[model samples]
Target: MKGRNSIQFRIITGLLLILLLSVGVSIYLTTANQKSNLLDASQRTLAVNNEMLNTTIRNIMLSGEAPIANRTMEDFRKITGFLEFELYRTDGSTAFNDYDTLNFVNDYQSMVMFDQTPRVEGRSIDTEDFQQVLMNKTPVISLNEDTREMEYYFPILNFAECRVCHGDDEFIRGVSHFRISLDSIYDQVRRAGVLMAVYFVSVGVILFTWILLLMHRTIIKPVLDIGETVNIAATGNLDIQVDLDRNDEVGELAGRVNHMISGLRERRDLELQNKVIETRLEENRKYLDHIKEGLLLLNSERRITGQYSVFLTKLFMREDIAGLSLADFIYPDAERFADERRDLDGFLEMLFTNKTADMDMIMSINPLNEAVLQLDQDNEIIIRADFLRIVENGEMENVMVIFENLTDIVHSRHELEEERQRRESELEQIATVLKMGPKVFEGFIEEGERAFGSLRGNLTNFSDKEFISEAFRSVHSVKGTARYLDFPGVEEHCHQLENLFAEVRDGSRKVDKSLEETVAGTLDSLDDELVLIRKLIDRFKEFSVGSESTQVSPFNVFGERINDMVKDISNELDKDVVFNLETDLESVPGLPEIQPSIFHLIRNALDHGLEDIYERLAAGKPSESQLSLRFIHEDNWLKIEVEDDGRGLDMPALEKKGVEMGLLKPGVHLPSQIVNVLFRPGFSSRDEATSISGRGVGLDAVKEDIKKMGGRINIRTSRGKGTTFVLLVPWKGDEEGVLV
Candidate 1:
């Protein structure tokens, strides 16, 4: 109903109003004309009747037949449809009245003799018609609405015959007045008005019905169909169309609606195509993200703009890098790249500015190529960045930056190089040992021992600058001798020691307690290597045909070997280490089998337990750090202790490394538990591999070796002070007799 009240109702209502107004106008005009014609016809008929009556009266008076004229007028009045007919004298007296039977039309004495009724008496005689008839002596006509009649007054003019009776005294004789009822004409007009009203109403009804049907067919029905089709299309049904077949505005509207739906359907198909393309693009993005290499797209402004692989986020450690300047993302702090020549900013600027430049040349000089980014204090990664220029429409549009993480590759290369160097050193040492016969090898070993022993004696009298100078000279001499002997391993160790002392003597490095301890550790390592070389030579000596009678004392050899190994460690670490040989080696038995264990313990102490010279001093210890090896004969156990005045075990650092290696859970542990971490296979406190302790095999091997020797090692440590390792070997034989 509400929908119907809109255009359809308004159009029908407007048409009805217009039709009604037209009908009302037509009825008003027709009725007005009909009334005018009817009134005019009545007036003309009254005038003609008055004229005929006047002429008849004149003829009758001329023929001398007044009684006959009077009778005729009486009969005419009776026969005519007039309400009243009368004659009045000029003095306002009636000449003849219809109500009086004795009155005569032209009787001169009858007006006074008879009982006369005035024609105009008790009537409105002051009217214009009566005034004109009486004063001007002319006929006057007027209507009387109360009686529904037309009144006419005619002046009776004096003529020749009228003067013979009246003596010719006046020009006007009397007035004749007639009142004619217009009721029949009024009835006809009323009936005609009613019929016209009915006719107009009928025409309005028929026109209204015809208009309603035509509008429904031409407008309302088409609009409804279009509305329904629009509703369907709104529901995502673009196939709906209004099939209006007409050459009208509605047809044009239907055509437009069909075109709109066709456009909608095409748009929907395009949307589906876009959806599929977006899905494929997303999948491709995922694939790119998972690839090993990182990718970045930079616009012409050298800003990261378009899509980038997710790996780039991981590589750069940032997520919201799009729309950011490429140089800014790579190097956020400009001050860090202050060196203009080697600055990454210059490289990027050059590459971005010079479109036609060779990318290979730019890449060759690219500082970011194989750049090392320190992720944190303990973590770093090497990355190789490559830039490729993307050209579009003969212009450089973008640059694709590729980042490849080279940390593992670089580390692997280092490890391989180290391994190769180790193998070459070993083979060279073996070759040199073979080339130099037993006598020459023995001479070299004895000379090395004497030189190291002298250096150790001099280090005991530790001074600052003079002592460092002497140390450098002594290590340099030993290094030169080892080089001459082609003992590359010993030579390299001596060279490192030489470098340490040289740095100290030249003031490049401080000769603090830590430095002294470090030197001591390095010296100990070098001596250990020498001893191993000596042992190797001795093995070679055993193969000699004439070497069977060489009876060397085990006690002296063991003591000397221990001293050499400790001194080597002290020098190797660049420390001023004072080694005390407290054990009387002559009292020990089975020295040969226990030598390896002793060596392992001393090496472990040097590498893991001992502190550098600076650390010893910082701990309020001597600048010449102390390391002691002692042997004691208990009731049934042979005990050896190795202790150092150096930094104790870092239990926290050990625990952290353990957690990282997945060897131990994260928590506080007992000192013994922390110490046991040292012996866990493949667990080390060091974050990186080097020539020393990170292998994780040393302490574990030592523990196994000690266990095989029927000994267990115990560790004691004090924070900021030092550490001690005590080995207890069970002995069953008599101590005195077991000595060799």
Candidate 2:
């Protein structure tokens, strides 16, 4: 509900009220003027009639007692209003009341020679205002008391010329009174009032109609237009302008309203644009934060201007390090140190010149006394820092300083070393359980007895690979237990075992299976001999040592492995499977590692190569298939292409299934390049859960295996034809460059 504007409404209402009041005033004045005119016209006619009647009566009254003729005055009175012919005697007695039709006939109803009304019979004998008509004191006109109907009365006096009857001092006095009727005038006035009321009412109606027209144009129409504008504005439609007909106040007001609306639209647009800008700004800020690695902005003076991420703060531990020279974070006397680094410069020059050089430097980091702040739950304390700057990089302007926290690394190494030792001890304990029988070979001696006298004779030198490998699993157990039981030189014996195993495992030569078997038997006897000794070691808290070794020397090829696989794939296809084998890698260069994963992809290609066996028969083609394995090397990248004469994947059905599974849009166009989404993790279109294809880990695992080696695999399919999978890869793996 909309509330009315009290001030404006009141102003309009007040103006209407004033108009009503003005109309009322005009009607009142008009009614009054009309009433006055009616009254004046009636009064003037009455006065003229009175004067004519009085002149006629005076002639008769002064005619010396001549009989008063009523003819002339009767006519005058009828023409005006009412006339009464009531004569008064000279002695004030009633002579005659001749006009019987007059209701104003007074106490003197007698007909006589004298009458009165409006100064009739102008004899000074007996007038209402004449004092000389008195017999002795000269009486004046006699008073006539008729009903007050605007009547005029006068007295007729006897004249001295002839007094027909006796009269005092030859003066006969009488009176006549005439009356005028105003009923007609009052009727006219009432008729005028009714007409005036009608006129005023009609005028008021006309005024009201005019006001409605004006308001419709000025107020109502404009308000309707504004309402329409408001509706459009609400709907976010900013195109329309209110069209108006006039340039009055309402028009001006509408113009202002339109202007205000335009301003609001502009503001809304501005705010929306600002919101988009703000969102992009926040997004850019996050992106900047993502890649801003250990960056420190510096001014022209090489002073730290600013730093933005947690990495910098962790490295420096000094938020207040700003405004400081860049070299302040370096080793003490960095200025002098930098100057003396010309040797590093010379080595760098040698690097560019391809000349070998080994430049090493030692530097220390001074720690601020402030305690290290710990925030991440998985953080360790940092106490000191030292850097081993080795100049090997030739392109950079700055020294390639490699800072290492040797203390932390060394501590970690110790902990890991302890864990390894404990694991070895546990394995040794398990071996003891496996050799629990005390009656060993029916010729066992004392628990402290060696396999032969002085067991260390054959393993004197631990550095030899074959002897060490055999000694660790065999004699190492005997030695650890012997030490636990206090056998002489037992600790030295176990250390020799550790050194021996390290050499053998890390050696270049491979140990034969026969040697391994031979060592296993010796290990069993040694574990049994040391079983009781291990119990003693547990009581004394002693453990055997552990070590790690790795060797990546080339191993012998399984010789006929590639030929065997090719024969197998071709045999399965039941056709001559061609091998466009790159001669350089006819035998897989890194066959030992790749053979495990490669066989799966190769087998899958052959098994599913049946391209509508019947259709092939009809097309005069062999039911069997042809498969080709092509391998090439270019620019450190190995490209292997696997092709087969087999039915391609049912792409339409696959896409439909993908849609039905709600993983893809109904009309999405699957890319033909990688049409085989079957390579995706856990993907299989084979309907059956269990198949000779192996349960789980199909092409998915193949893809994963390739990916784990930082390689990529892609498949291209052609319907009714065959599919080809291309595997591009790196022969060298991460094992070389791995930080660990």
**Which candidate number would show the highest lDDT if scored against the true structure?**
1
Q: Which is the leading candidate under TM-score? A: 1
Q: Estimate TM-scores for all models.
A: 0.33, 0.27
The count of residue-pair clashes in candidate 1 stands at 38
Clash totals, every prediction:
38, 25
| Whole-model lDDT values for every prediction | 0.71, 0.49
Q: Give Cα distance to truth, residue 404, candidate 1, Å.
A: 38
Q: What overall lDDT, based on C-alpha atoms, would model 2 receive against the true structure?
A: 0.49
Error of 1 at 517 (Å): 80
RMSD of each: 28.2, 34.6
Residue 495 in candidate 2 has what lDDT? 45
